[model samples]
Target: MSLLPPNKKKVAKETPRNFVIFGETMNGKTYFTEEFPNPINLNTDGNAEMIETPSINISHQRDSKGTITKSVSDVLSDVIDELQGTKHGFETIVLDTIDDIITLFEQEICEGEGVKSIGDIGWGKGHAMLEMMVRVLIMRLKELSMKKKVNILYISRSIDIEENDVSKQVPSLKKKWMNIVNGNSDYTILCRKIGKQYIRKVESKRKNYTRDKIDDEQIASLLDTVIGAYEKSKKTDVKDAKKIVEQQEKQEELEQKAKRKEREEEAAGESTKDNPDPKQDKQPEQAPKEVTKEPEQSKKQPTARRRPPRQARS
Candidate 1:
């Protein structure tokens, strides 16, 4: 009764991807994001002047007295609202350098708790609050991907980590926040500078990065390839499903024919038993007797009657 193809795993429909693109400073992390379709950058690092892509400056709000009114988190919420409420026609939304955004969030947390630094908060609650705030932001971006079909790209700088004397690069965020970002994102690509050429690490294998040459024009080709594979898998599933259905139909037809033949044979046997052929059931005929000529005797036989009753009366 299943709707999926026989012996084939079900594949989900293609949707926009959320990416965490991280690399060292000036390694083209922000520049590569512009290759996505119809992209707009949420410029938080004050580097919007360097990029030609459309961007919105995300900054804290202040009053005339220089007292802080709105936090960066609040401004991000407003941006999400505008994207959801209005038809912005933007296909991709980039958070330019999420490292700066995290820093702003930490500052906002410190200001709210009246502390000089995040560590001053009692019982390590400040870190927990910051993590929650970042998680909320990621969830909101996911909503945009779901409801509006928008792709989200978070840009960050990579920090090197040493483990077992092997160095590896990861996003420039705290371990807890980094885990959150990587878990929530569909892709965690690394931009590396190999000599003068820029290459992107699309996948990782046993500390060996799978590199792909990228430029401003073809940075988004990975997404295209993924979507194309999805389409091909879908078509294959449909074809397999149709073939299975046809096979089931043929098997059923054969079964029906067998049943019909069995029924006909039973009917013929019953008819033969009910009415047998008369010629085959008839008894054997005897020879006709010959009539012989005989002499006429003409003598009548006399009968002796009983007269005992009359004698007894006399």
Candidate 2:
């Protein structure tokens, strides 16, 4: 009665969490991400070298001809490819200082369009393209997280924005892009340095900023506390989990059936094109035959005269 095949039935996996950590420089934003399990940092702002974790430097590449070859966007794509195609023992992938990555995306857009700045592209299309690029990156990472059971952490520098004459600290990103980033992440934490002590803020008292208060402690354990809280929140009974798994299996079966039907339709179309139905093809009709009557009276008279001559001779 199971919807999934015997081999396809699997235990519920631990959901990987996406985190956005932002704070001022030297406030331990990068250092905090290192506390995650087996993290591989994608160095965007050259800050990864300062940490002891394994890191890949993402930047513009130059070819032998002394011309700029690959952009940072291309490098990031390669990194994603590596994660997808290769097997490296990494449980978490960190984007150190997402601000740099955003800037790189802008540069890439400008260079591709032959414009000096993103605004130079008329009709506000450049910003849209940049947002698209960033979203694509985040989506790809999310895919990796699901497929590989890896966590994602985005490190960003904090900036002070004065709105309504009130200063607020937030991630150093454009208002629109910041929303996208925060929306996709499971947790948005602010790291603050308070007199020789670094503390993480999980909740905000004011409406100017958004935060997911996972832990109540002002100084909780780094990665463990976050993961524990997330897991605890999602913890379900065994029967409930099984039901959820069954639902997922049924959905997968439905998707597979749809794909199979699509493939069959495509194959049928191709077959028809290669060898068409004979009935469907218009065959030329032959003209109707004309019927002619024979001269029957002439044959009857010749037979009667022969019979009379034979009788007289007898």
Candidate 3:
């Protein structure tokens, strides 16, 4: 680490994406979703016949009064529950015409507020609630895609609307909800019928995840362009990788410091060995030896005296 570094290292990781595919009445929107592996359709529009792939149809439950009605939340909750089951064997989750789900939510809101339309809720509360519901839905779908590791394809019909004095075909959802959906999705695919042939176009492509299992060559080509653009984008991933790199650098620095200290100690020892002190190198002096003497022996006069005394006694 330094005050002025060359550049911040950039890293990228795969992030699973959720897609929104929109088009006209019969421009291959549902068919496009079918290209995904093991797709389970949530037929909100009750138009499963149009989709060639089989789907999981959720029935409207009756209340205590025996009235056949369904709450949007209840239906979505059931789908989430099914997704939680590991034995379900669904690889992808498809929602045909998310516009229908929005309408269902609107109907539920109206029923709760005792109104004929969402506008009747007054003070734009209905719209606020609608946006909230849409946000929740988008968040849950993101969980399904990212946490559950399943691909999500939301199909919706396009509508011709004037935006900033220009008429453009967009997904048939309110502006707020549409913006949220587009922002959350990794790709917004636009399906259009040009002449007798249908064409798929990428309206937006900003995601870290790349979908590779596409059967249609044309659609796959378009997706390749999107993935290439994402690859070229200026993005950085601030994940645990950065932390791991920092830790490795720190460990290397500590090791280098230890090696330098050891070298310094060895050099000091070698200098002491090569340059000796004269005084300490000299041999110690020997102590002086003690002179020892033995006393002279006395003459044997006692023996002469003893012989004279014996002669006198005799």
**Top-lDDT structure, candidate number:** 1
Tens-digit lDDT track of model 1 for 188-267: 67888778977776532112112232222333355443222222212458888999788779867877998999999999
Q: What is the lDDT of candidate 2?
A: 0.75
Whole-model lDDT values for every prediction: 0.76, 0.75, 0.74
Q: Which sections of candidate 3 miss by over 4 Å?
A: 1-11, 49-51, 58-69, 161-167, 207-314
Question: What is the C-alpha lDDT profile of model 3 across 1-314, one tens digit per residue?
Answer: 77885677745444435788888987877767777767888887666666567775544566998554777678888778778765777777887768888887887788778889898888999989987898898888888777767777888888896544578888887767778888887778788888987777667766544445443344344465332423434555687669867877986787799899999999988878887675687788988888778877786645634444445553
Error of 2 at 138 (Å): 0.7
- Candidate 1 segments whose C-alpha is farther than 4 A from its true place: 1-11, 14-16, 203-220, 223-314
**What TM-score does prediction 2 earn?**
0.60
Candidate 3's TM-score: 0.60
Point out the worst 10-residue segment of candidate 1 by lDDT. 204-213
RMSD to native, candidate 1:
28.0
